[model samples]
Target: MIAGRVRGVLRPLSVVSIAIVLVLLIYGLLGYSVTAVVDGVLAGSVTSPSAAEQTLRWTVPLLLMGLGIAVAFKAGYFNVGAQGQMYVGAMASLVVGLWGDGRAPVLVIPLAFVAAVLAGAVWSLAAGLLRLLLGADEVVTSLMLNFVAVLLLQWSTSGPLKSRAGTGQAATSESIDAGYRISTSTGVSVPIFVICAAAVAVTAILVNWTRTGLEISLVGRNPVMARWQGINSTGVGLVVFGFSGGCAGLAGAVEAFGPAGSLRAGFSPQVGFMAVVVALVGGLGALGVLLAALFFGALRAASLYLPVVTNLPQSGIDLLSGVIALLITATGIPLLRRRRRRRRAPTAGGTSEVADRPVARRREVVAR
Candidate 1:
């Protein structure tokens, strides 16, 4: 157990180290000094108060979304529709905010939050139900839904919620009412921090100490065994997807009400995908996700700040993130396959327990 904990800590650290080295080497070959690059990264990410604030700003959404994705992952569903779910959530919040203009913030804000969560949960459940009822692949369906969501955002910003102001370059909704906004320009606030902290605490408890959490783990580890144990895998999948999408949606609402203050077309473009990396790198634990979100958030801050402070292109920082994602995925596959194989292997007596079971009971379990 001690060794496992140590390995867990080392895995994320190694990914970070390797990514940093690769970025440095690549940029060095491009003629930038290593010291300059390092200095710029630190200055842009955490050295200054403004940079630290920016890092936290990005961390909020990433952490919330990561937590949700981690749950889906643990339940054996690869629900990658967070981008679309987030868009839908933002659109829902925007509609509510627009309709509630001039109303008391206490009233409008809660309504907006509920609207966002429900919209997101429904969007995710659409994919989950398809998988459960029609045998559709959740990964493919969820990913396709992301494009649909982007289009929806585009139409809403261009047609329904389109701002009447003069700026024509970017399609965007009118700014949310000032009273309903969550934060100022900095995008970090006491309320926002409290919300994120509460999410982390709740998710941690739900995943680590609950009966549903055990079912989710069992389902992910071995669905057939889970079924034999009388767990409802389908119901678990629905719960996982709903929770995941709701988290993503809440993040979108936070973004819309906090720093964004309006829905912009293609807002937070690749954050959804990056959040998958955050979930995996953080080992899918609440505390781990928190730390990983901050790390990625710092990288995000540095990426934008690099172009301003040094000759390094923003892509350099992006490349580092990509490398880390690649490493995590590549390393995870073998371990997963190995576990599956070990679970199926025969006992020391050279007898296969599953094989020896009655054929009727050994049949491939189908979803209810």
Candidate 2:
């Protein structure tokens, strides 16, 4: 019994473990020195004080968005629009921060953060409601919205909010005053860390210790059964999606206020997508998501350092990420399909055997 339980627990863990080993193996075969790569990753991510800060900087947004993905996955929803949601949130924060015009930091900061969260939630709800009401696919809607959000950010930064006296290839909004900023350019700050800790704690409790969490899990496993149990599965679905988007928005606000300090075009472009990978690697558990965020954070930090040290292009890191996402997605598909086939095949075979046995028995009776 103990062995069986242990196997059950370890089964999910094997997926992430395999992915890590595979990534390492591929890196090794590419003529990249394993020690140097490992050491580089370590040296870049945490061996030095600056490296640790960089890791933390990357960790903040990844962790926030990963948590959002985890929640949606737990509810059996694929919210691929975190990137769009984050963009919208950042844009909203920018408008509020710039327009607030030097209000007390205590007041302006909280209000801007709240606006960001609400904007993100509302943006996500559009897709969620469409899925619930019109049967429009969430995946398609969310993915398309990402482009729309990106375009909107470009418009905002270049047209209206463009920083005066700023001249660069990329347009960006005026920087928030120092008092309104959450952290300096280095990204780590007491406020950012405190907010992240709170988010993690709250989400962990919601997933592990709340009735809503139980209902969300039940709906994910079987909506029909959940409905039979008198649960409002549709409502649960919307709430989960909204909450997930809101978290992504909160991460965007943090990026604007804490590290980036303004709305920049293409800011955090792929962090939302990376959060999806982090969610998958973390096995959709809050604690797992935390650890996975750290690992991916290390990778992000290392990616920046690689171009400086090695001859590898920054695009190489993107290629590696794309490969991992493809492999992981492919791996899950087979397992899911096999399980479905196993379930359906047994019923199909049983029915066919029952029909055949009756015919054979009749033939035996007629012959006798």
Q: Estimate each model's TM-score.
A: 0.91, 0.86
The TM-score leader among the candidates is 1
Model 1 weakest lDDT span, ten residues long: 339-348
Stretches of model 2 off by over 4 angstroms after superposition? 1-13, 333-368
Highest lDDT, which number? 1
Task: For candidate 2, write residues 42-83 as lDDT tens digits.
Answer: 777888559988988999899998898888877777788999
Candidate 2 lDDT: 0.79
Please list the C-alpha lDDT of all candidates, in the order they appear. 0.86, 0.79
User: 332 in model 2: Cα distance from truth in Å?
Assistant: 3.8
The whole-model C-alpha lDDT of candidate 1 against the native structure comes to: 0.86
The per-residue C-alpha lDDT of model 1 at residue 38 equals 86
lDDT of 1 by residue, 1-368 (tens): 79987897789788878878887898889898889878888998999659999899889889989999988877767788999999999999989999999999999998998899889999999988877666567779999999999999998999889999938888999888999999987789998998899889988998889999999888778866886799876788889999999999999999889999999899999899999889888877899999999999999988889888788888978888898999987875555444344232234443344545665464645321
Clashes of each: 0, 0
Q: Output candidate 1 Cα RMSD.
A: 5.6
TM-score of candidate 2 to 2 decimals: 0.86
